[model samples]
Target: MPDIAPQPGVVEALGQIVGARYVIGPGHDQEPYTTDWRGRYHGRAEAVVKPADAEEVAAVVRFCAENGIAVVPQGGNTGMCGAATPSPSGRSVVLRLDRLNRIRWTSRLGDAIAVDAGCILADVQRAAEAVDRLFPLSLGAEGSCQVGGNLSTNAGGTAVLRYGTMRELCLGLEVVLPDGRLLDLMTALRKDSTGYDVKGMFVGAEGTLGIITGAVLKLFPRPRASAVAMAMAEEPEQVLDLLALARTRLGDRLSSFEVMSRRQVEVIAQHMPDVVIPFGLESGWYALVEISDTLAGDALPPMLEAVLGEALEAGLVGDAIVASSEAQAAGLWRIRHSVSESSKAHGYVVSHDSVVPLEKQAEFIRAVEAAIIAAEPSATVVMHGHVGDGNIHVLGILDPARFASAEALRARAAEISLAVDGVLAPLGGAISAEHGIGVSNRERLRRVANPIELELMRHFKAVLDPQGLMNPGKVLPDALPA
Candidate 1:
């Protein structure tokens, strides 16, 4: 909580751009914009400006820039960290883009769709499906999360195994810079060897660089036929072996591959009745494999059967179950999605969205789990994530007995993360993975980020926002002021 002076004429200036009715400030109506999704960081904004379109957003940014006011571009406010929240000093304006919700169009030839920043992810998926296309970005927050936040974070969901993250799915973006200049880099074409590729920069910037207003996203032919198989393994290490064998056998047919721990599975089973574990026998770790095809033919079952047979013979998978019906496939996916909610229901936990190189995934998981358990045995460790992409989400729960003083446990968990990240550094893995380096992970960035890269990031931020008017305490480390 550093000191930040309130900029003059902030309310009047923004009120002139977007009507005063849409501008929220210093009142009960503005409370929600002052905090983050997790309720971890509570910020204070001079005003919350809801812009109806890209032009309105541009105007608001222009007014703020002229007055030397800071701006925090927010979407659905569904981010885990306080990346989208404003500062507590009340010097910044919260520019919410929810009013700009729109689906422009879908391109058949290029297999891409244009969407406004405020468009809900689930709605985008439905729009894509209307054109007989599949928007492969599937996450727990799809129903409520806005496309802008997802694009800003370069969100990676279950489908990252085949389709890739938001960075890979995004073709172009329309961004408004800190100085109020708009850069429309919306190229629907896939093969573009253009200069610099500026759109890619804003994808994972976490709104520190600029505000992402809209995007052209990659889409695929809707999967006409698909099969889901739940494979149980005696050990977490065997999940990697299972993935290796499936990748070889399934080839391009693989759609989704996720790994879940026993505790993670049990939590989902207990909380969500609709989502039952496909297999009754309890295993240490499990793999959820999805094989799909675009054409209207049921080739998924046979291919899955062949792969599972090989996996069983190789002693890689302990047990397996291929969903005989579509309802069953949805049930399995439901179980996978419930992991986060169930953990939250239990209590406070230290979550890490870390990733290692694919070949080193199992080894990384084993070493990190052992180290963490050894250090904090009473902690309920719920481990799971997009194993196909090597991103392992490790959640360390606090001891129920030590309910009143959880701060000590949280500090110890962070120390464990530092050690785990240290082990992952040599493998060229990211400590933050798909989740951007918000205020929460800023210090961790300092620890893990290369010094040269850190310097360059600071230099870039200075060049774009010389006065530090954009999201000030994000992405970059706070200790080293730019």
Candidate 2:
């Protein structure tokens, strides 16, 4: 595909907006900014613009709006899909938000923090913890990802079962509208029954509506004491039974419940040698569960022992091991964190982050496996996810030695995704669960999203970003000409 060029004057116009030092055009300066994390998509951009503050961002957007040039907002570029990268056509400018990084204000009194869009997620977590609070939205890319990207995607992580997604954790936002107007509505208040709750329209809009400058995030009290356990299960079904038992016994204290298949465990053990497993025995599936002690000086050992005992007697759990100390707990988490890295070691794979209703969680995983096997007899499917929220990361593995062509493997994976979508259609599940619908899943969104909901989305985008200059070709399908 040929690169898309903008009007002859777009580059010069942008240069005037943010100054020459901040604006980078084609050549060595722009080469490093062209690719994404997964190496799935690559495209050239006319220039990479770094705006230091909201004013510069607004100026750039206004210039693009006036010149009819499309703008693609990019932060950290840690997104799985090519949502952050410019399209193959080298016409658009990549508006990089890394320079906007800053910690504006944080309140220990009400458990809220205000941070710039470019602030790294890990930094935010540390800042919150410094004040004896927790910012629990965690993922594999937390170290490099930014708050803007999280809010834009409404990211969900292991803590979502307890703290909720980024949407729930967020209390306010400050955005730069498409036409260069600033929407300064960053109120860190909890209750405001004022009007339409307009701030929400851009929360998960995936940068289609506007460029998010900063946000106020809700925080929670840090867990006093934490316990981690690993349990073996006969199948995914047994895992569900174990969850019911744990919930009934542990109540709201359950912090994490991650389910992994035997295939996932085998790969992790093989690829990541540093991560140690307590037992040598194998099982059909496994769950790495965690609970937090809310009360001060509370004894967590007895509570954990009681739940494991009941799980064993009922045959819902096969075998279990609780972490003896904090060091052991970190080791268990390392195993869970290495899942994606292990899959990469196997060969080319297609990763899907989707969520089904909790009640049908086990059935959903089984159906995906069966459906993929039925569709492609040679395909190998490995499943792992935050089972507490019914969100599974289904990976289709293809041995590079057997299938030398990466393109062929990706094609097969896309077919499997289509089949998975067919299964999820009736269940009202999400195609892009934690990962937002970037350029990769835009078409799928059109196919699976409810029509009325999509209409509302389109109308809102049209109103806020009428010029279509904010992250064009993302979150929404290309607009049809009248």
Candidate 3:
């Protein structure tokens, strides 16, 4: 750990703002906030302050700004990238929003729900369900990940095929600006011909521009009938064909279309023996298809079955199993949800969250796989993602023994990432689909993004956070030499 020199009275001052019991000084207790969820990035903070509400958060930010201490805003600390982790410089304070968790209200009339930034994603979903509505932003980390973190990353999960990303799911935001001023834009209105979308800027800013304190999120009618199926295919093209077929047959009811490589499913099966894979891993690729309807009936299952039946007859699908019960549907989803945990247990994974055009997805995957193999032959590459939205998550697992050190492994991972980017560039795909450019891809984003785009981002960052105190070293890259 780096020697973190605490500024005189800084800890005491923070303790006063948000009760001494809520303020955790540097040491073992601060470990959880300092280290990222992946354990990839270890950082050091002078103190971790848990603010009770948005006002307390603003006060803490103001104090930090006055003292010239970097403030790293954290929520749940479930981010894959090191966005929430403080820098190892130790010249910073971690502002944790976990204590600010609260569901302010659920407006069925407005079709929206207002929540504190620290509210867990699952809690938000349940709160929406309480009112017979649906909060559709979900992923493996929904149980622990906070709404603010999801908003920061503009997360895209399985349901993105139907509901869209977090950006679209959110209606408005309540942010604490760098200067400690609360900027409230929490509106539930679906239509607003507002000039310059200020809230949208913070949606995917990754806490660079401001700290997201609360949000008004859009809600939808809960699905009364749903069907889930695990379909096997010989190749990526076949999976794409099935996606097209599903869309043509089910239309808006096609909620999720997830693709997983054979290795991805096998890893889940190996690590999570309790989770059952509906179909054996005989095929090269598998897709988890889900269709949902607001109306209650037995029609959903038959509709899903008909789609799969046609695909199977057309040679697009090899074999398929539709979940006959709610328990069965949950079991089928367990396999997809278990992927991240299983992959972590398998080995050091060099993960990529890239999205390509629907037409070029197959080609992009093929070229990227080939490039990865050519770059590192010994690696086991596993692929999966929301195929309906063209987001493909590629994981290259490497043996720890092959690398001499962590630094060596990271270097190799960077090399492989570059190779994947090389393939992605030609396909007109984005380097980052949903995950924002935190520490992991900061430089990569600078290299890949257009000059004008980078310029505009820097301008916005400079205008909002002139001192660069709000979540420093995240999202936007470091300024270039004058």
lDDT of 3 by residue, 338-364 (tens): 889999999998889899999999999
TM-score of each: 0.94, 0.94, 0.98
Judging by lDDT against the true structure, name the best candidate. Answer: 3
Model 2 error, position 23 (Å) = 2.5
lDDT string for model 2 (1-482, tens) is 54445457666777787777888876556666778877777877777899899999988888777766677888888888777887777767789889888888888898999999999999999999988888999888889899999999999888887889999999999999888899998999999999988889888888888899999999888888888899998878889888888888988889889988888888888888888977654788889899996576547767887899898998988799898889998988888888888888876677778788887777778888888887677666888999888898888776655655877666777787888888777776888878888888877788899899988888887778776667777777665211
Ranking by lDDT: 3, 1, 2
Give, for candidate 1, the lowest lDDT window spanning 10 residues: 1-10
Task: Give the candidate number with the greatest TM-score.
Answer: 3
| Two-way TM-score contest, 1 vs 3, winner | 3
> How far is each candidate from the true structure, as Cα RMSD in Å?
2.4, 2.3, 1.5
Off by over 4 Å in 3: 479-482
* Better candidate number, 2 or 3, judged by TM-score: 3
Alpha carbon deviation, residue 58, candidate 3 (Å): 0.6
Q: By TM-score, how accurate is candidate 2?
A: 0.94
